[model samples]
Target: MARPLSPKLSPSIIAQAALDAVDHDGEFTIQGIAKKLKVSPSSLYNHIDSKADVIELMRGQVMGRMDLSGVDSESADWAGSLRIIALHYRNAYALNPRLLPLVTAYSVRDATTIGMYNLMAQTLRTAGFDSTRQLEIITVIDNFVLGSALDAGAPDNVWAPGEAASPELRAALDAGLGAPDRAQKSFEFGLGLLLEGLAREAEVLG
Candidate 1:
């Protein structure tokens, strides 16, 4: 016998519902969101026009959670800045790993997302990379960070070397697997390797 105190329909509500769907279902449909919100499909359209639109909103929502206000390419250490950015980037996406496939299929138009990439590019440029090299480094970091985010879902014993596994591979697994922070430690380790390699490559090209 009482009216609801709040309006259920809003851009942020739509985005959050879509994110929840993606987090639980690996993808979302307008129909799915409508059902979850107990609204008709036409109602969802009032807030979001297309899957792409919803995705951009969700992207912005996730990207906004990262603290990039401290990113200053002109003053920060390029490698250190990139390391911080990559870590934050990976952690943000790790929260919604199920959304990865859907988001990756769409071109990034979210301003926060674009700004993060621009910061990465600018930092690489400050490290003496040319435009082309900046693009390459960004791609490398993107691939690695995205992969690392997805990898967060893996079990603690990420690799289980079998009886037929190579001794070298088994040795490496023994050194690395079965830890609570296996994925996280591996991500940091790989990131360091990648950043170091980029620095060396930048030097060689200079």
Candidate 2:
């Protein structure tokens, strides 16, 4: 019998199956993905070596959603470039908040994800950040973006101080919590603060 024109499974298919599982169940297993794909668990090994490989593929799927090429390292507007990249990164993860923990647990070996980092590094290098500072800046941005992404999935009432709440804390939550696009507004506000500080640091480094 002749084999089918298209192979039975591809990396993208496997990754998407696992991602679907994660999206619904908050985790995935090789067997689970195989069942989802209507294939035996052993067949999954033909396309993926281990769970880490599937995680990387899922990472790539998320990262592929962002268009990083729009970042203009040559423009010398490092803050602008960084902001664009950060927003893109945060938005991508916001779609799959459950995947965030898994991706963070594993070492990032996904080419697309690494490419996004490379663009950010290039933007920093172009703006006069030294190699040491580049990594630090990238890490800071990564932490902030991930935290903000998690916030996107936060409950409408992120904090419920109730009777225990101080007047100031209660007032703050009353004004901000449950606000429309609260998470996005907060992320932008925080991003602005970070960019301002980094801009000052860049000036001092010059």
Q: Pick the candidate with the highest lDDT.
A: 2
Go through the candidates in order and give each one's C-alpha lDDT. 0.87, 0.91
Give the per-residue lDDT of model 1 (tens digit) for 89-138: 99999888887888889999988899999998889888888898799889
Tell me the lDDT of candidate 2. 0.91
Point out the worst 10-residue segment of candidate 1 by lDDT: 3-12
- The residue pairs that clash in candidate 1, if any, are none
Count clashes in each candidate, considering only residues at least 3 apart in sequence or on different chains.
Answer: 0, 0
lDDT of 2 by residue, 123-181 (tens): 99988999999999999999999999999988998998779999999989988889979
Positional deviation of residue 203's Cα in model 1 after best superposition, in angstroms: 2.9
TM-score for candidate 1, please give it: 0.89
- How well does candidate 1 match the true structure, expressed as C-alpha RMSD? 2.3
